[model samples]
Target chain A: MQPYPITAMALCNGMGDSTAAVLAALRAGRSGLGPCPAEFELDAVVGAVPGPLPPLPGSLERVRDTRQTRIAAVALAELQAPLARACARWGADRVGVVLGTSTGGIEASEGAYAHAHAHGGALPSHYDVERSHALDAVLHLARVFGGGLAGPAYVVSTACSSSAKVFASAQRLLAAGLCDAVLVGGVDSLCRLTVRGFAGLEVLSSAPCRPFSRERAGINIGEGAALLLVERTGEGPARLLGVGESSDAYHMTSPHPEGLGARLAMERALQLAGLVAADVDHVNAHGTGTRQNDSMESQAIRAVFAGAPAPAVVATKGYTGHMLGAAGATEVAFVVDAIAGGYLPASVGADPLDEALGVDVVTARREQRTRAALSNSFAFGGSNCSVLVGGPA
Target chain B: MSAPGFSVRGLGFWAPGYPDLAAWQARPDACPEDQSATPKAELLPPMMRRRTSLLTRMAAEVAAQALRAGGLDPTGATLVYGSVYGEIRTTLDLLAALLVAGEPLSPTKFHNSVHNTAAGYVSIATGSRAGNAALSAGRSTLAMGLLECAALVAAGEGDVVLVIAEEPLPEPLAAGRRWGPFAAAFALAAPASSDMPATTCRLEQGPNDKSLAPARPAPAWLADNPCAAALALVDALAAGAPARVALEPHLAAGWHCGLGAGA
Candidate 1:
């Protein structure tokens, strides 16, 4: 497959709202984990976006005005200029939108549930189920930028791997001459269902998450959105070289014991890029900080790049918590920023790396000119996606 | 907007009236639709059969029908599942548990509630290792799935098994909406394949006003449920002619899928 250019990107996560702010925090190895502030009954730390989301403009007044859509609106606003430029470069009909999400406007539904419970099971009039549909984010973006996109607009919702898989579909669309450019990203907002659900499963860490550490506990749920404009003929700072996807087919929740699916996805990604494991300079792992996830990911990494100098293994979840469906694209944006700035962000929370894993876990910021990087996102239901990004060779 | 290198080789559908392609072709003008009862699918293993929801079963049944029609191996075909509303029953169950009892969601419900639950179950049942994608785009779902599947086949990825489905929302959540459950599947293959069905088709984006509507007055379910729009495509295919379906109210153009004379 041919590489596609990443022309522009916008991010809003726990560490910061802009690329500059997030890069600064990363270079300083700052942890964005803080006390749980969303009033969930579960006791756990989280990486929530600070401050209120910027209000949606009047143009999008008809769309559902939920927290998730508002967060997506912020990212969409940032990409407006470049998106418009792309629309001019290629007619609006040639530009598409592909977004990923797990729980879309679910918090709105939860709020409605709360209201209904308080009033003897009578729901509020404004509580429409379509507002909470998983496709809300896509509709919100489409409604916001009504005439700018007229191709392949949809939402991919495969739990956490949702966004990363968007790259695969985008590549196919471009390679098959379906669309000239695409607006691809992911958005997920905090909701009681996810937080409480993870807590019941005993995977929500009460303390800050620590990936790849001997004492690593579990994940910290977070919320945010990440958007990028990918085109076939743009002079962008980074390129999506290849994407590999696979399903675990083992357990619905727990990953394959041997990380079989994860390993296959990485190997397939490297193969598609026509590069050896040694060509990768950095690894952005889906280290959810859970004991099972960290352990399985470590084994998978070791197996994929066996006998080669290991890439700088780092996990950004500690800085932004796990953004669920949005994690893949958010982490990809974070890695692209690191590559452009010529530094490798450290894995902030993991200390005293687990000796059993045999992986080089980055613990401190390092100044290195990274040429190619790999990002992994493994979701529930055993879905795994790996994306390779790099600058011009 | 031309899908120059792709073709739709097979099609399958399931709903209140239609059970599969053969049954539908046998009686296209049956009134009030078939309303035949959907039997328990024996294709899946016991565990999966038990775990599978009615919605998932509808999708898988149609997918199997298409795959059989195309004579393609499930393991070699990429799966793309599209939906308007996904697993509404499970979603309502989970929400009720959370709001009424303040209890954690059951692991089964949690897994089943994901949009890709049907894709997961299909892969497990057939042992498919190929890539899979599950997506949603409201009423344009079937059109979007057709576009995506065409792209995949045009890229020479592999044969694609595309499934689109929707079930009615819980009465409270549904309010006055009258849509019911429906699912459709298609086996889309690249041009000139030996196993290809007679209906070799390609999709192109064309004038918006050229968009198609149901030939007859649509049933309440067909009018409201997005996935049911797939029946329009089936209707056109059964007529052995070229047709287009409007993805409007969303996109600027409708999809024009044409079948070759062999169809």
Candidate 2:
């Protein structure tokens, strides 16, 4: 349960392109979601990354070129210098890659389907399904393109909790001495499948999402990528103390009614981190703004810190939207910002907090020393993961 | 370099031609078209049973068999699932629906498309709250999956059921590799005293020469099946011999696994 150093980090999402930019926007109280375009044929607001994405370089285009890889390339480029230094420190063969994704470059498949229709049900030969749409798309992108990491490498795809679970895998690899350093990341880009799929489920909000508010609507889906370098000998101002995982064993797409799995994951994370409820300074919630998720998460937070004054809980989805697979890593980036900047971002858009919820939903920034924080990301099939982060001891 | 050692308490296998390890070992070289009663899936309730994809049913069936063989309790075990592509049948259906107008994509299919659908369903059916992980590494999937199982054992997770599955790939997506549906599960734990046969397993980073090849040649019909790599280890266990098996022959470098006698 010893803390691992976050030696280097790169983040690109609706909030901002770099960790610093994201932190700045968090401090300034800004919303990154905008109205969804008519082409999407959806009414909800979305967190689409603006501007151009860097193209895949050279032979990577043959197997790893896609919207997901392009989005990951943006963040991986920001992480180049530090990542390269770490990879050099530990030979490429000694570093591992564990990436999480919900729908890996699925936009390519959508295009392929349209192309198949035009060509009488023949998919375009130029596309590589394994490289682009499979769960390992980003794993190959980061391993092969992220300096050819040759150690243990794999991809985790458990819906929304996809990327957050990567940290657990990294922890195990480092704990087992399989790698000196591991690059753990998550990347999911917007595609017709998810946008329309959620629409069919009636969980897409026409207006900006409002987490934990009585008047809350559903989620505003987002797209982006976040990567972090964690080392066994990690020493720095930031640290990943622990990761706790659990399954609801209840339902797919729906959380346990009483937040049972969420509470278990948080309790397990606390156990791993060697911390008590009172030690936590803040909680970055998996507040997807869905009525079910917010209520369930609130119940879990209150239960985890029962009898003690629960820490300030903030939902930054208003800033980053719901990045789905990328939410965990990106929101954890927000926690790093808080640890370094000595302040907490208010739960943006959480106005007139829902009375039934029993947790402190921070409505304004509070400048304070945040020594430890917990970040929650739960996904379909009741897959739950909670990561503990804090300033160096 | 060898990692910490674990033991395989039980093993299970399912494929188009071979329904179980006994059948596979009996006729490894024969390509049988005999229709066996594919999994009855008695554990799954009626409503949930209707939603399972072929991949999920295949995995759950093998998982149940492994647990029964190992005489292990599902409550105390963790589930580790690996697949090159997960729930492709459900995903393809979702994609096709997306291409049409007015008709909404089936929410059930969309939810079932997750790579971990099998783990989730099996966990629920078995009442396993021990947690689960779903992963993939393309050709290196089985190797990475076994490594994860070893790591979990070393991390004090007690017992783990490692399930590796791959449903048949559709055209263009197959990319010219003619692999059929395959799924396998092995219940593993720390070396313990028991009357049942067990294979001592350790993951090592070394050359491929030490790897064991199945005594019976694999049927030529199914080629490049990811889960097929585990057959060598299963064969070593069936033979009750100490040997090294190549989890992945060509892709993941130095994934030579050693199996031997165990309690």
Candidate 3:
């Protein structure tokens, strides 16, 4: 196989105080989703961060310009000090920034718009053009590093595939000698828009999301960020072996029933890595729990790995809920963690796999050494991106 | 064994108040209309038109023009659509509804607000079951689109790929941005023969530093502008001569230049 090109250093998933809650859920094979008793009319399940968000530090506040940015700020706070030290060692210019987000500061925009309409006039001076757009999050990170002028800063928003696409983009950029290192990750905050939007789609389950199960229902809306520092080096660190990106353009809201796009994306990644289907040890399925999505993905997996023994499939969305744009990076972090920890976390809430969807869906935590894993991310508009992560060759 | 690369074959563009290619080329400095009505839905079938946002409509129209100019059908062709502000109007509307009415957001609008919405819609429209991709990199949206399109072609993913870029003048977004809204697309394919035009596009890092060089005459200056690269494509094809054009890099501080010449 052509060796995986990009390596990942220091991966972190920020679930606020809910990290323990989620970890428990993972250990107990439970889902973090529960009833939302909020004033909203919708009766839906939410994979909400278990507790209050950590307070932003004064240093961060001075630079914090928006609420969503602040959410991203908090999400990255755990890694900032370590990342800073790493940047110093790696040279700031060599480090690039690629952030995937569905709504960078949409929450802030909604707030500002509300304030303006109610009171008339303009928003705070800081709520400028950059803050309103999704790209601003990456720009903010670039500024924080004092390396805005040094390297590339990109923001990718391909809906649910946004964060996953960032991984692919980062790999390409690094492979092409664009940057020696890149901070490839995603950040998204819960906003009324996303919550109501999902509710409108009638895909939000009032109970904890059950993925890949006969009784599986719908997905829970959740938000947080996951950050991974990827470096192009000859040794050490978890290597990013391959990436496949394709758009189905099949439907705006629904995936193609045949899973043609998903299959193509997975096949492309394996081909890029010069490996056959059998090389993959684990499948981190998109598994959003929606009927069409889960069923379609199951068929795609069955088609790709058909005759050969299917890889153990697990869906992490049951734990983190669907982080939307951040889902790709957040799930990738889980894959990296699984590799680092030398175990595969059970597909929380998965039980009695659907009869029609023929695949070995992992339900209980299993301790197994994994050399390579494929992480799948499918977004609206049939945009599918898959990333292959593996141990160093 | 060599890596794949993109080669431009045909180009087309459409903008408000600019009906055709000739009109757009003649009025390079034409500003966007202060206000323009949305095109009538009858132009496209309701099933196809219902899902298209303003940006998607403009993109589809421009892509069709590009295919016609290239004398190719987009059927079974790969596609790449790039826009810095993807379906911003729809996004703004959704956000506004959430803020004011606290209403249930439209699922269609929410889904269509994604970066690949237009590309996906185009594929559905053309029944092009080939690869489709979307990219964005701030001001260099078109450049990035071109880069991805070239990579796909080189990779042997498809014989021909469509690269389309569109930005619409939503009053809110255009309020402070300098450039006017426009749509440009190109049908890029592998060279059919030695006589086909040869094209090379390269992306590099550094700061944009073009002022030191003396400005060329008006015609030459216009030829060098990156936006004019689309026009240079048409010129090169028409005049059957080699052409070199410079484009501002999307990420780097320097210029990204392309050189093409027909055999």
DockQ rank order? 2, 1, 3
Name the lDDT value of residue A392 in candidate 1: 55
State candidate 3's DockQ: 0.35
Model 1 C-alpha lDDT per residue in residues B157-208, reported as the tens digit of each score: 7788888888776655666676657677778777777754556776766665
DockQ of each: 0.58, 0.69, 0.35
Q: Model 1, range A1-393, lDDT digits (tens) per residue?
A: 899999999888787776566667877888777876655554668877776777655455446677788778777777878888888889887998888998787777777767776786666776677754446445556535634577778888898999999888888888888889988889998877787778767788888888988888899998888888899897887899999988877777888878888998998888888988998989999999998998899889999989778888989998999999899999899888888888888898788888788889988888988888989998876789999999854
Clashing pairs in model 1? B17-B34
Which pairs of residues collide in model 3?
Answer: A45-A205, B4-B154, B6-B150, B206-B253, B206-B254, B207-B253, B207-B254, B208-B253, B208-B254
> Root-mean-square deviation of each candidate, in angstroms?
2.5, 2.1, 4.8
- Model 3 TM-score (2 dp): 0.84
Among all windows of 10 consecutive residues in model 1 chain B, the one with the lowest summed lDDT is: B210-219
Off by over 4 Å in 1: A39-42, A58-62, A117-122, A132-134, A142-147, B27-39, B100-102, B208-217, B245-252, B261-263
- After superposing candidate 2, which stretches have Cα over 4 Å from the reference? A37-42, B34-38, B193-196, B210-216, B261-263
Q: What tens-digit string does per-residue lDDT give for candidate 2 at A324-366?
A: 8899998887888789889988888998899789788888888
